[model samples]
Target: MEELEAELAQLSGKLELARESLKRLRITRETVTEVLAEMEPEMPVVAVDAGPPRSGERVVSAYAGAERRVIGVLTVPNWQPGMMPDVLPSAYRDIVEVVADAPGPIRAKQIVPRIGLPAETGKIEGTRAKLKRLVERGWLDEEAPGLWACSPSSTACSGSCCG
Candidate 1:
């Protein structure tokens, strides 16, 4: 009986320690999230009345008997001859401009800080995702794995980075 009581006490102590550790971790996570939210710029919100539209489709809303097209802030439209970086979301435009201004190919990590984002892993990966999307849409080129540069055909790069 005494041995069982000692073991139970040990388990209780361990349980308390685990609870305390979990509480501390939760608090740390909350604080870090708050700090990050404050540090990051406010992203523009797009209100779509209907379900999410297919990529490259413009959202139209009828207001006062007139239809107005709304550009999605997160959409990356495929590049065309006359399409300019102005059509991209501000974040994407920033990345393109950074790449266009660079002397050669750059990595997401290098672009992150240049575009005013923290050089954290999450930021770098998010930037990499945008970079890949731009490549897919012909706004940028991937010379090799993880290396990004302005696409030669892109109007944003024609006279600047690619030249």
Candidate 2:
């Protein structure tokens, strides 16, 4: 009877220790999760700009099978309703002029050259703006941000794909 009582006492003590250990483990796990969560810092995100005021949404655009950052997105301004002319023809003529005159894809203010008209292609408004208009009218293609190229569409560059 004495030996049985001693064994029961030992088993009770072990059960109590196990319960305490389980409680401590739960508390430790909670503490670790909270600490890890607090370790991460929040990042700031700004909205999109219209003009040159650091505007525009942070849209992740895909280029050539890889993701790219959209540095800027400019909308077209002088688009007539009926005239709906081909955007690239006029712009292409101007780009050809500038390339024949002085060849360089240098930035002319906000307008990225080669993507549209050259900075010196015309003395009108912005070359980039013309490119945007052309893109809207299916004339040119903006392969990526700050990287515009003559579109490889059926109507635009017909020979390349069709032929």
lDDT of each: 0.75, 0.43
lDDT of 2 by residue, 10-71 (tens): 99999999999988976765564344334322211122333332233233322233333333
Tens digit per residue, CA lDDT, model 1, 45-121: 33235456545444443323333333323367778887678767889989999998889999999999999999999
TM-score of 1: 0.55
Give candidate 2's TM-score: 0.27
Residue pairs with colliding backbones in model 2 are: 48-55, 48-56, 48-57, 49-55, 49-56
Q: Tell me the lDDT of candidate 1.
A: 0.75
For candidate 2, the per-residue lDDT at 145 reads 63
User: Model 1 off-target regions past 4 Å?
Assistant: 1-74, 159-163
